[model samples]
Target chain A: MLAKRIIPCLDIKNGRTVKGINFENIRDAGDPIELASFYASQGADELVFLDIIATFENRKTLANLVKKVAHEINIPFIVGGGISSIEDVSILLNAGADKISINSYAVRNPIQIEKLAGFFGSQCIVVAIDTKYIDDDWFVYLNGGRIRLPLKAFDWAKQAESAGAGEILLTSMNHDGTKKGFAMDITMQLSKNLSIPVIASGGGGCMKDFLDVFEKAEADAALAASIFHYKEIEIPALKKYLNENNVETRL
Target chain B: MKVVIIKYNSGNVCSLANALERLGIRPILSDEPDELISADKVIFPGVGEAGNAMKYLKEKGLHLIIPELKQDVLGICLGMQLMCAHSEEGNTDCLNIFPLYVKKFVINKEDKYKIPHVGWNNIVLNNEVNSKLYLNTENNKYVYFVHSYYVEKGIFTSSETTYIIPFSASLKKDNFYAVQYHPEKSGKTGETILRNFINL
Candidate 1:
């Protein structure tokens, strides 16, 4: 059986790990590579490092950090935030990043999804959609959930799938820092509609939230930041709890 | 001991080198048949399309050199798929070292299983098989995998994993070994498997 994945997303700013509050006010968490190694050692199914600082000066820092992470951590880790073209992806993958996730660039130029998928199989390309509920519909947001687009979340996700994105990292902006739970209704609908894996992000609080996301929403993976980073919810304990609840977590 | 990683245009086989480096073994990444043939162990690692990988392997004549090498050769992910008879992906013919057909996972609307099984999944080691690849590795240990197609369980299957259907997670035929999962990225369980392969 394919186990439901528990991912610890480390938002990176200048090679350091930071956790954002609803994608805005951020504070330092730790070193990205050390946190990545800790998560991998603690039985994290996978790790995602979003380079929140996508500046020209930070590109080399991100790449150099990726090489160090690849050298140390044995588990698969994804690098995202500022990836736009094939050349950018080539540099990261060659540095030993397992997969690369894209958001703002992908939404602006959707055709790049197909081109990246064509060049480096769809399995390596992940499209991250930041969504917020407004006016009775979930709207897609870019620039770390600051800029909202006119696109509907569900429709855009379907389009991304058709364009050859291997996975969808759906983050609910409204429930991001609430620490209540994931937006189960939208997540369930998208999970049923898309053939690719949907990683429910942004609103996980406790072990039950993860259980709810997997058992109720049927998301293939669940990603959270502060909850795991701050030691509020330990990964091994969470997985053990999820497994005892019959959620099929890898323990 | 010369450990050569059979390199082609596959995506991110350098991760394999880093994994071996953690085990204190530096591997030679090369496409030369002479290097692959003379190495004590060869790792055929890949993460890309079957047809494209096979095309590159054949163009470099590695398709011919790999099977003839008498040393132990291990294949990972697409490398394992290319060792099979055929793949539904791009309708490409593989090296046929395992004689099993590789087919894409059909998206069953009723099951709703994801197309690419992209996570950590456990594998049940076949106790009957004498492959030392899982020597220190425990049965039902989780390993990372990211592929849409799978090789059917056959006489050469050394370990099995069930998703939508039962399939060979690892296969062995004399001097050749292949695993559909990424031991290089499978954390400690994967480290054990890689160590076992290196010690072989």
Candidate 2:
């Protein structure tokens, strides 16, 4: 059986790993490459480096940082943030990233997903959806989950899957960093509807949180920041816990 | 030495090249037959539909040269599937080097095990002494895999994995060796597997 994935997302700014509460008030965590290699050694299935700093200077540094991390780690690394064109995907992929993730740009111009998927197979392109709950329904958010859109979370995921996206990363702004648990309602609905793999992001605080998301939400993978970043939860330990919980993991 | 990666309208060339470079080996991307035949090792990788991949290989005339080569040859994911006797993806014919046929996973319907088994899974060695890919790893050590169809468990299977069905995860015959998993994406275990292949 295919093992469920445990992913640790790193928000990068000027070659350093940073974290924030709901995409604001960025605080430095550690060096980007060092933390990435550490996560790989700790048995993370994949790593996602989001270039939160979208400035030109930071973009160049993020590119260099991607090269540094790819040089050391042996797992799949996904690069996102400010990836506006195919050329950007090429540069990051050539620099050693196995896949390139797109968010704001992908929602604005949906054809970019098809174009990227056509050039580089759908497996190499990941479409991330940041969502916030509103009036009993979930709405898609762009620009780091600040601007909520009219399109619902499930609809966007269906559209993205139909557009040939290999995987969809769905993050809940309402539960992000709250340590309550995953957005099981949305994740369960999306996983049931979308044929493609769905990665549950945000609101994981412990091993039970991972188990809850996998069993209840039916997520293919779980992404976390604070729990992994602050050393509250380690990947190998979590995998071990999930294994004990009867979830198939690569342990 | 510049390694010429045979380009036959397939993905995974860049990742293979990157994996090689990690091992201090620089490879070249080439679809030209002469370039491929002259390289140190020929790596054929695919990530799309299986039958169409074989059609592209046959059209390029690389199919004939692939089996006759005395040099090392490796296939990754769909690349490995194309090396078998036949595939059920498009119900197309394959090279038949390993004498195996790829088949679709039959669903129980009552259960929800669907096609395209994606993500990391185990590698259980079928032949302990002859297995090169599973060397240095413990029995049932896991590796990354992504595919809808798999080579049915048979005499040619080197390593096997069990999900909805027990299937061949790696196959080996003389110099022709291939894995249904992506070593480039799998962590240390996959890196060591690729390293063993490059060294072999």
What are the interface RMSDs of all the models? 0.9, 2.3
RMSD of each: 1.1, 2.4
Docking class for candidate 1: high
TM-score per prediction, in order, is 0.98, 0.92
Give every candidate's TM-score on chain A: 0.98, 0.98
- Among the numbered candidates, top lDDT falls to 1
Q: Please give the TM-score of chain B in predicted model 2.
A: 0.93
Worst 10 residues of 1 chain B by lDDT: B105-114
Clashes of each: 0, 2
Error of 2 at A58 (Å): 4.4
TM-score (chain B) for candidate 1 is 0.98
Cand. 1 TM to true fold? 0.98
* lDDT tens readout by residue for model 1, B46-102: 888888889999999999999888999999999999999999989999999999999
